[model samples]
Target: MKPYIFSILFLLITSISVAQTKEVLLKKSFKVDENTILNLDLDNANVHIIESKDDKIHFDYQIIFYNYSRRKINDLLDDTSINTSKNQNQIFLKVKNSLYLGIDIKYKPNFDYKNFNNPINDVYKEYLKKYYKTYRKSENLYKTKDSLIEEINFSIGRDMDNYIKKEIDNFPLKKPLKTDKKIEKNFIIEVPKYVQLKIKALESDIKCDYDILTEFKMDSFKGIFKFKRIDGKNNQITSSNGILETYGIKNSRIQLRDMYKVNIGSISNSKLKLEKTKTKIGEIRKNVSINDSNSKLYLYNFGKNFTKFNLTGDYSEINLYNVKDTNFSMDISGYNTALNMNGTKTSFGASKEKELTKILQKKKKENSPFLGNIEVLLKNGIINIK
Candidate 1:
């Protein structure tokens, strides 16, 4: 057989051997009160956590596998395990061991059956009928099936219609395959509104929303976290090579470090610690204190009644925008820094000046007596206030 024909045969055989399947690995619930804490450790999974009115904590862990044989799936099921234990008011859930399943490849052949059923085929059939109507007693040109196929090919080759010609030209003669692959594990966890979460995860995504939890803490390595409208007193998140995003935070303390990207929105009375991260804040309300290092921070806007803003960082880029409407006083102290306020640029520590300190005040109201105070101490960086 030809090499291409052999390749097609092998692909069809392989495709026929494997099938897509899903299996529930674990389904369990824990009885807890308002003060319960959930300590979870997982890898290679997506966790969706939401608040529930019920006092019990419910979680479902499952696996979705593709292009794998039943035997292989059974082997994987035997090898995977999740460990759980209860410790006082805290429930511990951890992944003991799991084998890495090979990536799944979804193959699609280039040949489309619907394209072969074109209107041109119907026209050719009509022509065949009309031609045979007149030559019924005479020697027919399409005497055998092979001769009919040849006539169809000839007609398609000689067609002048652009649509038909383009279709024929674009259609692949060889049944080449297109492939895509994805591997996913998912967990849906539901807990009480007042419960706390302590999670340590790797290469996983987590999403939570709309709960007045006591605390939300996670130490993740290489993953994405998204929190929407979550209210808490002490919510701390730390990640390395990860993305952290929050839509709303209220009266919370958040510590984030070593993140690739960070986006925080509409926070009030919060304490934030950032290190080696690229951060963006949508709005600051009330008061906020930030301590950062070797990062870039961008503040988009401020709330009307915000009274305090303090930032301390080194080797960073700090940008504050749209603060001209607020009455505030800024005390900046840093060395080897570039300060740009209202397009006025100043450099520090590059000349004879050492440990320079500059004070700036913006008063949009009469007799406001500095409604806000902005303090910044940074080294070897750029600060922009406008």
Candidate 2:
């Protein structure tokens, strides 16, 4: 078999496979009311659930957490939450139906910490060691050195202030504590107060709408095949009878081709009004004024060269209002070729020169050597002997 033939066959197979195995990604957010129990299975890392609530809101949650990685739950928790003290690390409670006014359960890297090595203490001790070393060295130098040492001490003090400020800025600031204390006499100020509670309740079945979003990359091939229109209404199609149609040929390349026929049936009180605008190629516009109350449009594309072919079709249906102010036009061209062998070499030639000439004459006449060459090719082959 020829290389081009194999290439075309492989393209058809790949296109069919791709069409069969295509998937879509969807992402959405939903709001749940307060006091709702959420049962989540965290077996899949791609799936997650989060909860939030106001003062009057309460919620019970049952989640089966799974760690696909080799790391333990404690390690994951430690990574997710910040630990300020060397000896103290916040522990996550695990039980069925642990109720809370608000609960957020998604993967948290910093909070997943449970191990022999305490990162918080290790980091603080390193900082303290550096601070003490610098301070002690500077103090000793101030006592031993001359007047230049005073300037050095001043610089050291400024450096220490800046370092402390930066460290303080790095620390996470906690929210201020709220309190209510009534004073006996002198000017008592009144303030509103609300309390939130976290409670534990039994796990119950709840309807959960799960939405998954994912993206996959796969290798595939693509090809263009011809499609035929089975039915039409209110308009006449030039290629209505079963015929091979091609559109737009540039540099010996067929831009578009339709292997199927186009058929347009009768329409009642049908009118086709087209308005055209000048473009780089030519005038282009919208086609309106064809309205059929009871009619259907049938279309199909046929694949050749291979027994079975995959087709991907996309169509845009435009509904136009007010035909008096509408514009539309169409430009189509193509090449039809037949292969012939003269001696040992094979040549390709077109088979529709006179037909194309008649069609072109109906639209517009353009006298060009390029078209004349095409006409000659249609009569003979790509090559001819005198």
Candidate 3:
């Protein structure tokens, strides 16, 4: 037998002897007033928030792990230590080490939560504190804010890699060559109808099936987010490297970076900033502004109340359908951009002028002026209006 195959078989036999699966469930609830807000921060978990009729907040945390020792399971439970508190109409629920430096913390199987020289949990906490401190003081720095955040993210990645490798070397003989390990977490939060939500997550899927309250705020990195109805007055979302799908957004301010896919069912009175994203909108109501860079945008339909639209993009593609039926006056300014209005192709920047401007009018009723106004500024892109 080959040496590699023999080693694999040996490891499998060893795993079969000690492999075990376990599940943990934790539930908590708290009462609140009419003006309460739920502030949540977590990482690496599937989180679902449902609207409740009662005047309270309910949290259900579930965890499952396969092929993990009892000691490791205990560590995981400790790492997931949820902190819940209430202060003056504000409720806070924080997951201490939700991801704990990524799932399946296989390194240092016998990790000691009480005493350890280089435990990942401790290192993570310390570095996170430093990172936030740096962020708070970034306004005074010469470097841009985004650059500073990127630098800190890179630093954390490098430091964690080094620490994990160093810890793995300590148990070289006892560490299994191949361990079938998996950890899954599902968290559900039930809140009252009047409560608002503020969430910050990392690599976690966030879903809300019902209508939200008066406010909603989200900041996430690399996750999938879906909300059925966002009936709120103040809403803000900041996400990157993720997928977002939402519907019925009354008002919102959204910033997307490098998103894989985004879909908005119906949105009105909103501001959007996009970077390297692919986005589709079902219908657009009135008073919306969009700034895009290196993105692909699709607008399928327009609402009858759409009164104002302002769009600016560079190196982007925008397609608007069913424009002939809408009552709007469009002012298009393009530089090095292609325009295909009802299959009549036109190129800007071909003439001696730096830019080209065109006006289009579509009246819903005869002798009646356009009900809405649209302004577009684009460069190095394509605009399709049909």
Work out the TM-score per prediction. 0.70, 0.12, 0.70
Indicate the worst ten consecutive residues by lDDT in candidate 3. 149-158
For residues 1-386, what per-residue lDDT tens digits would candidate 3 score against the true structure?
69999999766755452354545455889997778889988777677788876887899977666666655676667766677888888999877554652443434343335556645445446545664565446422233223432332222122343244444455434343244365655677898878888999888777786778578899999877778778788799999998787766778999999998776777789999999988777777888889999998877666766888888999988887656665666677778888888669878775556655553444455565555777888878788886
Full candidate order by lDDT, most accurate first: 3, 1, 2
Please report the candidate that would top lDDT against the real structure. 3
lDDT of each: 0.66, 0.21, 0.71
* Clash-forming residue pairs, model 3: none
Clashing residue pairs in all predictions, respectively, total 0, 29, 0
lDDT minimum window of 10 residues, candidate 2: 275-284
* Model 1 misplaced stretches (Cα beyond 4 Å): 1-19, 71-79, 96-178, 341-345, 359-364, 367-371
TM-score of 1: 0.70
Q: What are the runs in model 3 whose C-alpha is more than 4 Å off?
A: 1-22, 66-72, 96-182, 341-345, 350-353, 359-371
Quote the lDDT for 141 in model 1. 19
Q: What is the lDDT of residue 210 in candidate 3?
A: 79
